[model samples]
Target: ARKNGRVGIVTLAKRPWLTESARIFLPGLDLEKLLDELQIPVFYAFEHVSRRVASFGTPNSYVAAKRNAMSECLAQLFGEAKQCSSAMSIGDSEIELLAIQELMSELAMSRFSTPLESPLQFCKTVLLRENPSLVQLQRQIESLANSLGSLVDHPGDLSLELGTGRRLRLRNHLGPNLR
Candidate 1:
């Protein structure tokens, strides 16, 4: 209701109805104390099997995400329900993420090496630069080049779409002669 430019606001009074299994503690949540600690407008939360995870959000999306995340966290923690693999967690969540492999293997009805199939490899900037051997560097460079080429092609026919809509002209940002 305030003139803040945001999709929505989740007030503390109406926040509890977001999830089924997650319990929120309001009296325990000292808003002023938290703001003093974090130095940010952190106000909302989702939950795990135990603990409160608080942060700010865009009401509807936040509440929806909190519901989904709490559900998955409860599932994973209790080993009863399924974890939402794609759910991203904030530092405030106080929840530990079991590797995707663990969740996939546990939920699989048939025996298949899903984890082995999708091994996550992170090449940090420093690691990809000053940290590898010559052969490793070359391999990484080739991989990077391939990724660049994939993005170089147009995502959609931009010319075809704009041609029929109206007369179009390019701005002279590329230098007056080029434009």
Candidate 2:
């Protein structure tokens, strides 16, 4: 494994029952310490690799798999950070976050009684009626998407900046042009 151009070796183990099954070895950083600091279980890396191998083919190398797993973990961390920051901006407590989670859960469970043109429209209607505070957040998200212009239509061309000083490219495997 390599972190910031520094070459290191990672040792991973799999155990079906253990929570922190995966392990890593680096020159300066301790895997257990790092995971503790990040507040993420070591098994997250294993879970990521397992899911990737199940969905796609096995990775070419352990290093590649490790890098991909780390990328996924970092992306998740950044997403949580973005959500927390947005929620904090709205209020001091976690009410906004909890409300958003509840709204998403409700949306997922809802079986729209009436036929709608699109699921997005249905969601918008529900949000407008159920939670007005989320309307501004939705608009902000839509504005961000709109700023991407044509990239919004072509997911393969979309690259998301996760506020981690890195750009994550959306790969469209099923698309005719895989770039």
- Which parts of model 1 are misplaced by more than 4 Å? 1-85, 96-111, 119-179
lDDT of 2 by residue, 1-179 (tens): 12211111212345432323333223455555664655644322345455556355333433344444433433354553112111101111222223333332233234243224113311000111123356655664574445433332332323243222344444222122222
Worst 10 residues of 2 by lDDT: 121-130
For residues 1-179, write the lDDT of model 1, one tens digit per residue. Answer: 11211111122224434331133535456555543454323223343212332344444434444444444543534354342222221121112122222333243322234534432211101013334566865665675444433322323111111112233222211112211
Model 1 TM-score is 0.19
Q: Candidate 1 — what's its lDDT?
A: 0.30
* Candidate 2 segments whose C-alpha is farther than 4 A from its true place: 1-11, 16-40, 43-46, 50-59, 80-179
Candidate 1: residue 29 Cα off by (Å): 19
- Clash count, one per candidate: 1, 0
Q: How far is candidate 1 from the true structure (C-alpha RMSD, Å)?
A: 20.8
How high is each candidate's TM-score? 0.19, 0.22
